[model samples]
Target: YHLAREKKGMSLRPPYRQPHHLASAISLIGGGTYPKPGEISLAHRGVLFLDELGEFSRKTLDMLRQPMESGEVTISRVKQTVTYPSSFTLIAATNPCPCGYYGSRERYCTCTPRQVTDYQLKVSGPILDRLDFVLSLKSSGLQEKAASETSAEIRHRIGCVRSLQHERYGSHSLNATVSYQQLERTAGFSEVQLQRIGIVCFEQKWSNRTQVKLLRLARTIADLQGSETMTDSAIQEAIEWRKLPNVLQGGEHLGPT
Candidate 1:
């Protein structure tokens, strides 16, 4: 029984696991009388998408922090100890509030301020800090437009960018995973841009981790534009993209300086 799992293993062609919001800690993190791999491990070298992110228990979510940072999860039992690779890309989606209509122009929010605060706080600060960027999206009706770049063309452009990054930081390195010092040395931020970032960070009271993430995002934006050096527009765009609404503590708006 379960022979296919035992022999062939759970690696799909680019494995993608979307665990339900009701998934238990044991199911997601892999723990039982006899321990085995979990969704994070099953998604190795692939993706772990958490939809309706706020619906998961905070404890279950926090359990992801260690494995996410270490790229592996260790389970120790009386009979055996197991380590599983968990190097999967994490993509989570959540609503702006409990009723999911907060800030919507077409619909009025049904949630009270306290309820909204509680819902937003489900995803804790540590998780937010670890995230590279947070984007808030609003639904819009589709309209006719001119032809844009095809998927093939976009892929080719991305491939070229990857090659450029590889040349800069060896075969295995990309802007997201590179060390701070290495990136900073060649990030190409001018003196004025650096000073502006410093001032903004101070004003916003951003954590050291957040500041570094901003730089990494800016660096990638520059790379995407085929720019050898970071530009003011790139830095500003990164700032806007990375701006986290102050929802954790119940703020009604985001004044992303």
Candidate 2:
């Protein structure tokens, strides 16, 4: 924070931690007789990758709920309580099912309907609700016909948006971290817009927290284009995040935009 505030260049080293198969709840969520920081804390202000996401133990994965929502993980030990920052951009990859062939165009899924259902249940509904965006991607193994934009190019664009947000908020407060009243006022949601959101919440059975998340996503969408006021299209784009087939299958598939 000091380096950034002073306009000095901090090294671009973001932590990337992956706790794959055989990873325990204690390892992922941080817990022991003597509490210690876990993968989430290591990945703070960075990315945490969960590979073979569906194969993870349900109970262990569920432990992510609190930290994913609050940006901090608390481990209560016999002697003390340890709290660690876990504000991370979570990235997960996995097959559509346990057999690793559920949606594959080439391989047929051998798992039965009930098996697929049970396998996906490892990621619960509440966990799915906590995710910001979801994308249903087709399998692609072939080389790209066109060259895609590099990560550096994307980062430069995101940096411009971050600068705008910093200027507006007078700090590094993200759209996700801003208070509701500030969001409503700064984003300038009109009565009609408010009604649209309300109707979505009702139709989708979204909780108040989910409603706030949608608002934040809308704010970020507008911010990406340097728009002071959130637009209807931004809200619609945010709404589509939850409607993806991956989300419908109870997977938290949010990735950095």
Q: Worst lDDT window (10 residues) for model 1?
A: 248-257
Top candidate on lDDT is 1
lDDT of each: 0.78, 0.76
Model 2 RMSD in angstroms = 4.9
| Model 1: CA > 4 A from native | 1-12, 142-147, 247-257
Report the C-alpha lDDT of model 1 over 178-197, residue by residue, as the tens digit.
Answer: 88888888778778887888
Full-model lDDT, candidate 2: 0.76
Q: What is the lDDT of residue 112 in candidate 2?
A: 98
Clashing pairs in 2: none
Error of 2 at 250 (Å): 14
**Residue 251 lDDT in model 1?**
15
